[model samples]
Target: MDLKNVDLNLLVVFNDLLNTGRVGQTAERLGMTQPAVSNCLARLRRLLGDDLFIRTQQGMVPTPYAEALAEPVSYALGAIHSALNQSVVFDPARSRQNFVIAMTDIGEIHFLPALMARLAAVAPGVSVSTVRNLSIDLPREMEAGNVHLAIGLLPDLQTGFFQRRLFGQHYVCLYRHGHPLDHPGGMTLEDFTAAEHVGVVAAGTGHGIVDDLLARMGVARRLRLQVPHFVAVGHILRNTDMVATVPQVLAQCIAGPFGLSWCAHPVSLPEVSIGLFWHSKFHRDAANQWLRAQIVAIRPDGVDGGRTEDGATAL
Candidate 1:
């Protein structure tokens, strides 16, 4: 097959078929008549030299060849779309670009507000959407052009992507401002273990780093609740005597607004390194570079005015 002779639009039909499983539904999704979609699929079959999909009792099922090609083909289409949409020179003041980012709730609380403020001053028309960073395949997502940027503590990222360390976040113990723990100067390990706790277990498998650290030291707390998101932990801590361990930056941000007080975690926990990540394909992209520079500039400075081992500012 001559690759140059292929029309890229066939991939669109291919993707639609894969997603919807029925020709009629695929046609509706692509905003094309059923016959047109069928014609396109036929052409695709001729070019690929195989029946990409077969009629099944359930719906249209992809052949083994189609299944093998799905990810790479989708990535190719997405990259082409991004390249075509790329502006030669990005003027934030006048350009209207919608950026999608994958980040944790903690990231939203600490970074997004400042980022939005900067965007408002520069590119008022620019918009951003945040999605949950639950998947471990972020590098693949970046390569596929599904996500423009990702921000979080991804310590084990593979090669072929660029990462800029943003900051180091340690754990902090948080409780209501007037809680009994606030009677003295600060909380001690004994006070922390004695209190009722609300554990934020976003991943659902293991106890958080704080809890893990305590367990290593043979200390355990009365964990009254476990929630998926840090936001819920804050809500519960505000209304009850349940204390929770949260990222220091996130705790600082919510402490004032929610009438919460924070102290350093009694047991030493590993600091999470938050960073900005992007694909290497976008390394020389002018707009991507500009956005990256702006993000780095807006990040908070280091504690000792030097970068940490993870290349982020010490917090």
Candidate 2:
């Protein structure tokens, strides 16, 4: 456990392995030979007294001990990197940095076009990639630098992360413009519960924010259709007698184009708070800070700052 005896460089290899899960790729990323990377892994195993990674058919699968070490090691390495490059200048126009973000389909629809346009005008050399927010290991993914930021209604984040409120959302029921429920006062909690519903499962738990709220109120709608992506909800509603409760922002953007009409939820539900979340490790990184600022600039008004009794907002 002597700090002097440990080669801190192994942590870099370990961090890369966590992201890439392959020694050859990790070696290429770190500019080291494959043999040298293997050597480093051996030393790391001895130092930590655990088989950090095991080769498998899929890839180098990390052991439970390795999974536990990933966060702190990546955090420490990132802090060291930030400290060393504290004076480094970031010019988005000239930098070819690729940023990966985690967000839901609805967030992408509402945010990406504006964000991409802004970046294209100013930071032509920079590119952004998005992955689904259904990743259960989002905090760990951010800590490993795989996900630069997660933008959505993320209520699962615990400590070791930072969040900034972007906007508040409320539920709105959407249906075809000519559906029976489109009439005034025709849509109620009773009508909604009895109607055929389209369920958009956004999280890994196979439930969306709307479903969670209904469950809290001891209500369950008849789910005639279940889809994992939000984009499909519009199509399903336009073609069926089903209804869906979605974020108001999403309804505004998609309702008109999809030949649908929307109204406020008949039942009271907690407001949805959308935010930008990132691990504390990247809080001081110049590129990450710039990206966060860009996201904040694109944020709409009426951001609800309400927090749950536990101080965490539920998605």
Per-residue alpha-carbon lDDT of model 1 for 1-315, expressed as tens digits? Answer: 678998988988897677677899878767899999999999999988999999989889999999898767765765665587566778889878888788888778877889999999988988888877565446555654567777777544545566777777788889998999976568888998899998887662122555677788898989999888887767788899988888888888899988999988887888876777776556556677667766776776633325432453211
Worst 10 residues of 2 by lDDT: 306-315
The number of clashing residue pairs in model 2 is 0
lDDT for model 1, on a 0 to 1 scale?
0.76
Superposed Cα deviation of residue 82, candidate 1 (Å) = 6.4
Candidate 2 regions exceeding 4 Å error are 48-50, 54-68, 134-141, 205-209, 302-315
Q: Candidate 1 vs. truth: CA RMSD?
A: 5.4
Q: Which of the numbered candidates is closest to the native, going by highest lDDT?
A: 2
lDDT of 1 at 170: 84
Residue 234 error, candidate 1, Å: 3.5
